[model samples]
Target: MSDILVLYYSQGGAVRDMAQLIARGIDSVPDMRARLRTVPKVSANCEATEPEIPATGAPYVELKDLEECVGLALGSPTRFGNMAAPMKYFLDGTTSLWLKGALIGKPAAVFTSTGSQHGGNESTLLTMMLPLLHHGMLIVGLPYSEPALASTTSGGTPYGASHIGGASDDRPITEDERKLCIALGKRLAITAAKLVA
Candidate 1:
């Protein structure tokens, strides 16, 4: 079976929940599976170190995961209209993969969770694409063809799947947002399958 790496960094659990929904969508396809992984948190002190394994949730990501996956679904919570620091820290360490073209030609997608409706979910998704584009991966986005994109009042975008987590990051993923996450996952998995076949 081929694997689609679902890599994310979620502060309030919203992005992580979205990642799981996307993984379910990917696994719905024959011969495709999801490899869920998370990044370690960045240290503000600049000298502190996180434990090798997290207390809970997915394990920290490794560069080998990127090299081995047939496709990618990158998700993170939004921070000032950008990706969270942990995800960025992890991506910044992928120069070795970039040098070897490890992700080139693979299908990839992005997702994000924002604290508010106007809190930059789309921009975070778009900005996240910039590095993947540089890595030569093909970006797969949720098309308008996905009905949820047009009907979603909570969170769904042509750029990617998203969720509005509220200011306290307590809101649950809406039905529309959930569907779009699944759709995006299926889309990425299907595209990866075609390429592999």
Candidate 2:
């Protein structure tokens, strides 16, 4: 089975929940499985270190995860219309992967959770694609055919899956948002499998 990495950095649990939904969709496809992973926070004190294993959530991502995965579904919480700093910090460290073009032609998609409806969901997804593009990955996005894109009042978008987590990050993922996340994941997994075939 090929593993499609569901990689994310979620602050309020909303994005993490979205990742789980996406993983479910990926697993629904034959010959595909989801590998969930996360990144540790970047310390303000340069000398500070994170525990070898995170106390909660998925294990921290390692560089090898990139080479081992057939596809990627990346997620993060939106910060100022862009991905959180932790996710960006992690991506900045992947130069070795870029040097070898290890991710070339792999299928990839993005997702994010924002504090408000007008918050940077689309921009976050868009910005998140830059590094993937640099790696020569094929960008996967939700097409207009997905009914939720047209109907979702709270987060689904053509750019990728998204959720409005409210000002205090207390909002739950709406049914429409959940469905779109799954659809994106399924689409990504199926596409990856086809590419491999």
Candidate 3:
């Protein structure tokens, strides 16, 4: 079975839940498996550091994961309409991969959770794609054909999957958002499988 990397940096747990949903979708496809991973939180104090292993949740992503995965689904909570610093920090360290064109031709998709309906869901997803694009990966996105995209009052977009987590990070992923996230993952997995075939 081919592996698809489902990498994410989530603070409030909403993005993490979305990642799991996406992984489920990827795993649903024949001969495809989801490899869940997460980035460590970035600290403002230069001397501060996270433990080598997280106390819980997915492992810290390694460069090898990027090198080995057939496809990628990236997720993060929005920080002022952009990806959070931790996720960006992790991507910044991928210069070695970029130099070698390691991610070239692979399928990639982005997802994000924001504080409100207009709180940078689409913008965050768009910005997250830039680095993947720079790495020469093909961007995979949701299509309007997904009924949830048209019906979602919460968070669903053609750009990618998204969630409106509310100001207090309390809102749940709506049914439409859940469906779209799964659809994006399934679509990305299928595309990657076809490319490698």
Q: In model 1, which runs have C-alpha deviations exceeding 4 angstroms?
A: 45-49
RMSD in angstroms between candidate 3 and the native structure over all alpha carbons:
1.1
Q: Clashes in candidate 3: how many?
A: 0
TM-score of 2: 0.97
Query: Candidate 3: deviation at residue 76, Å?
Result: 0.4
Model 3 stretches astray by more than 4 angstroms? 45-48
The lDDT values for all models are 0.93, 0.94, 0.94
* lDDT, candidate 3, 1-197, per-residue tens: 99999999988999999999999999999999999999888787422168989999999999999999999999999999999988888898899999999999999999999999899999999999999999999999999999999999999889899999999888888999999999999999999999999
Clashing pairs in 1: none
lDDT by residue (146-179, candidate 2, tens digit) is: 9999999999988899999999889889999999
- TM-score of every candidate relative to the true structure: 0.97, 0.97, 0.98
Worst-scoring 10-residue span by lDDT in model 2? 41-50
* Candidate 3, poorest ten consecutive residues by summed lDDT: 41-50
